[model samples]
Target chain A: MRDAYHDELRALTGRLVEMTRLVRSAMSRATTALLDSDLPLAESVISRDKDVNQLCEEIETSIFGLMATQQPVAVDLRTVITALRMAADLERMGDLAVHVAKIARMRHPDSAVPAEIRDSILEMGQIAERLVTKTGSCILTQNAELAQELEQDDDHMDRLHRRLFRMLLSESWEHGIEPAIDITLIGRYYERYADHAVRVAQDVVYMVTGSRVGE
Target chain B: MRDAYHDELRALTGRLVEMTRLVRSAMSRATTALLDSDLPLAESVISRDKDVNQLCEEIETSIFGLMATQQPVAVDLRTVITALRMAADLERMGDLAVHVAKIARMRHPDSAVPAEIRDSILEMGQIAERLVTKTGSCILTQNAELAQELEQDDDHMDRLHRRLFRMLLSESWEHGIEPAIDITLIGRYYERYADHAVRVAQDVVYMVTGSRVGE
Candidate 1:
């Protein structure tokens, strides 16, 4: 019985890593769709969010089952509870990606990225993907050091986020209000995606070390 | 020992309700700050958020202690877990309010809401406070019926959110890009605040009925 319980806990970790992979893909494709104005790609990102939601639900169910039967104690209990928090963060990351995709759909056939701001948005997207990838690795490897790396990536994301605003507010901005609004929201989506990814990494650190990062 | 466990559970509910009250006050003052350009009020809202965070930490510590000592099963297990989820949602709502407060601080001495869109923003703030008030009641009473009301309030918030964008994009919008950007982010903060409140209510419903609403 104890062996099965540990196996179930391992399976829970596997599912969380899977969630990170899906969210990463969603963010990657959503970025492409935004930059290229590919309607189909945007639609795919939006539709596949359900898969992330389902995985989160599965994780919750398994954690509840584990708690009810095994009554996980000490580090094991911390692991399951931390898994629940990580899954929630990962699910929100998926939603943030969809929010980005929806911007692509809203402005279909017209790329949301203005020429001057394109590089910033592209960098933000790249940072988002990098953060989530690291988040996945952190969850799978339980590497507290790798988790520490996510904070630096999140700082880079924040710098890119501020740069995007600078571009928007610069005197050279010719994109007008509509695109500015889109970019403001799109920048927000990427920043929030990075934040959630960082949160998942934090949860991993907490699970492994039983201590929170930066807290 | 069982009686002590149940008392802790009741205390958990009290803490959640206290969180809701803190979040509600935060939003209320945040809205006034945004509308009145009240820097002190905004600063107050921002500083008070740590209080909310501290309460959440206390709740988590108490829940962990309860789970370890009692090994609560079945409905009690669900109750403790749901309380954790509700605390998280409430904490996020506090952050969202702080986001709104920050916008007010950013534009201090100049109101963030333009005169034309002021009413809609005010209404959004009112709805946010209402939703959280009901959320507090739902947690205290475990009233599934009252929990259902939060969905309708959230729908109203969504409608107001849409209305905000329409005003910003309208031909008569004379505020230009800077204020438009501020309003865009302000609108998003309130919308997300409402979404979190609704989630708390949903968790309350699930805690009471052992089922989810709108799922």
Candidate 2:
């Protein structure tokens, strides 16, 4: 009994790491879709979402199996349950990135955003990529400081997001439907991606400290 | 052992129901804050978030404890895992409501928005309230179809949100900065509330059908 329980715990951790890797790849691909303005890459992210979603389900299955079979206690239970929550967060983060990729398709060859937004998207992508990497590390190592860093990273992303929105709303923008929609969707995607990264941090904090981490 | 497992499952269900109640209340308070422009009510939602956070932690502890002890397999594993994911989604929905309340403090009492906006906010509140209720029911009954209804409702909210943003961005009027921000924030909150509601529905589908539902 003890051996089986131990094995499931280890497997649960393994599955979580695998899930995080899928998120990292998906985020990376989605960002590539944004940067290159490649609809096919964007579509691929949308297609590959199933893999992340499947990983999430598999982890959930593990947690349920652990409960029914192992009946884990205290910290073990926390770890398994945390795996479930973390998988959900990661899956949603993938979805947010895919949404960003779709929004990137908002531009036409002749209708690219002005220099101001193009620059902001470039900067925003860099920050988001770094944050995703750090968030995965937080999960892999259970590093609370890395988790804590996500809040600050999210703040930076929010600032960029606001700047992007202001640029869109500023008098400088040429009044057009498609360009405006692109900006709104872009803002929503970046804002949500940061929000998910924060959730990843919160998950790590929950797993490590077992304390309520306020958003 | 079977009876014990059943007892544990019952207990987890009870806790999930309780968590649902807290989220529903949080959403309710947020809606009141929006319609009445009640900053104090919003503050209450913000303050009560600690309670929501505490409840989330408690649920995770409970589920993990059950899993560690029972070591259940297959379908049972899936149910608890879904609960963990649902808890986080519900908690996030609550935070979005608190965000709406925070934006309320920024609104100007004397500045008048177009009549269209007033109706839209009112409509958003009603739609938001319905989604919250649907999510609560979905969680309790594992009602995937009812949850699907909420997904369609989200499309309606999205359309309304797009319309609101268009009006806000137009050069039509001299509404002050605070009001503009307030409206922007409120529109965003409702849109996201609908998004989380869809997430909850997806979870319900997973639990009921054992297949991940696509958005």
Per-candidate TM-scores read 0.99, 0.79
Considering just chain B, what TM-score does every model have?
0.99, 0.88
- lDDT by residue (A5-119, candidate 1, tens digit) is 9899889989999999999999999999999999999999999999999999999999999999999988988989889999999999999999999999999989888988888
lDDT of 2 by residue, B95-165 (tens): 88777776654452432234447788878878887877777777778777897798889989999998887
Q: Pick the DockQ winner.
A: 1
Stretches off by above 4 angstroms in model 2 are A1-15, A62-70, A110-112, A165-181, A205-215, B1-22, B28-32, B65-78, B110-113, B138-145, B158-185, B201-215
Residues B77-98, candidate 1: write the lDDT tens digits. 9999889989999999999999
Candidate 1 residue A45 C-alpha distance from true site, Å: 0.6
- The CAPRI quality class of candidate 1 comes to high
Task: Please state how well chain A of candidate 1 matches the true chain A, as a TM-score.
Answer: 0.98
Clashing pairs in 1: none
Interface RMSD of 1: 0.7
